[model samples]
Target: MFYFSVSMREVAFIKQNKEKWLNFEKTIYNNQFKNPDELSSLYIHLMNDLAYAQTYYPKSKTISYLNQLASAAFQRIYRTKREKTNRFISFWKTEVPLIVYQFRRYVLYSFLIFGLFVTIGAVSAAYDDSFVRLILGDGYVNTTLENIEKGDPVAIYKSGSNWGSFIGITLNNLYVGLLSFIYGVFGGFGTGYILMHNGIMVGAFQYFFHDQGVLWESVRGIWIHGAMEIFAIVIEGAAGLLLGASILFPKTYSRMASFKMGLKNGIKILISTFPFTFAAGFLEGFVTRYSNIMPNWLSVGIILITLSMISFYYLIYPHIVHRKLKTHVSTL
Candidate 1:
């Protein structure tokens, strides 16, 4: 039997493939690949070489050089491969829902907190006449009171041109949603505060209309947009709380790593709410203005449809997608 020392084998391995390795490195650095197949072929060959090097000459500098070359080739091949799905469509269909499902507890918590604050606002307003004014601000309360007397309680929606109102309302809602997500850095208390403030205002505002004997009318108008608008806000609050929780409790990861993960996932959830927010603004600006003149059935239908659409997307659809994916993964 022939005997070959490890050092001789390592030197012979380097000598045999040194030119090919150098050429591959040049091809990668210069972006000189002819096509995806060529790049993939190079990557495969390099990986095989890497496996051989790792097994035999694990302590050699040749291993480091080949490893670097393999990494670069792999990155290039990965970047060049065509995506199998439309990224934008996939983001909405798979990515957002999965993230929402993963952190679903936060969503439930957000809804409960907001609901509790809303109840407090309604109860306080019921007991104290000044509570509405105190929460809603004197100017808004006075204007709404006058609008109530005029028998067009939601006339505020009719003030601006459709485009102007749509743009302004959309911008404001986006701002609020963003603030809710950003405030999560304060360990989620900031997000809770935003939800509380919005919930209280909504509760007080609704109670005021109820007290004035136009509860149904206000519901018809406000909820035309409020259904989607308020739901989106609650989801945004959840994203914020998720962010805070990531920092407060970095389970297996370091705090910074956990924060990055949380922020990425939280941002996805927040971005998912944008379409609903815009839809809400459109309804508020264009559709809501006609609440008084539009038939009750039509207004009610709009409210139900908008509410159902948003509710299905955020709440029900996530579970469906998650279950389907989980089942498919298990089968595989």
Candidate 2:
């Protein structure tokens, strides 16, 4: 009879706090912590409740419920602590890489569009001498020709102090990347336009070098940094496409919800390009200037390594990470 009464009292206690406990769980999982202090207070209150239940209702279902809630709260707290401590490490290791894996199809599509534009530019330049001059602009073409005559076709890369050029180029590239991403709000057409424009410019630029009979020389110089720079632009385009795609095909999610998720995810992918963009700019400013002096093999080697690193991180590492994460979850 005493045991029955004890069980009844435990049941009554659970009935009183069950809603609050469930609400806490909902808030924790949903990441609705606008006021972390409030959450901390609630956590303390929950711990106290768990202690009471453990002392009086040890073997009861009420005690079990409290224990689980406490455990969840603890886990959440521990996770939050880790996230704060390892914010940068977590971002590269998990956040950005996962986002890249999730939106790979967009990346491929962006790459195809860019490649098509490059081909168009190259073909146009090949068939029409006027086409290179037109696309590249008269002043730029004339200046490059003058430099070529001076036996310094790639002299433009030596224009500024290494650090000065690095800062300027990095900022410009970042701005371009940001614009490419921001334009996705227009249903991705803007991003495609940017990609097409840049692709044509690259093709025209390369063709001009070829027309001047400096194709190989220009490549050895420009590609030392162009590999990463160009690759980052393509990735940025992919991010924009993701934004446009979410709105066009929300699937089961509401349009707003889909847009929010896309925006969040797109930003992550864009951020992942920053380090590469900076590296490219650094190489362009400090190293590309000496392209004429560097050994052909050394220049080619740098370009190859840059391409490999970008390819592996954006294209290959994501797959490895996704598979590993999936396996980890399956084990759980």
State the lDDT of candidate 2 residue by residue for 108-209, as single tens digits: 999999999998998888888898878878988888888899988888889989999999999999999999999998899999989998999898899889
**lDDT winner:** 1
Residue pairs with backbone atoms closer than 3 Å in model 1 (clashes): none
Lowest-scoring 10 consecutive residues by lDDT in candidate 1? 323-332
Q: Whole-model Cα lDDT per candidate?
A: 0.85, 0.82
After superposition, which runs of candidate 1 have C-alpha atoms over 4 Å from their true positions?
A: 1-84
Report how far residue 116 has shifted in candidate 1, in Å.
0.5
| C-alpha-based local distance difference test score of model 1 | 0.85
Clashes of each: 0, 0
State the lDDT of candidate 1 residue by residue for 63-158, as single tens digits.
Answer: 656755654454455446565878788789777887787788999999999999999889999999999999988988888889988999998779
How far residue 176's Cα lies from its native spot in candidate 1, in Å, is: 0.5
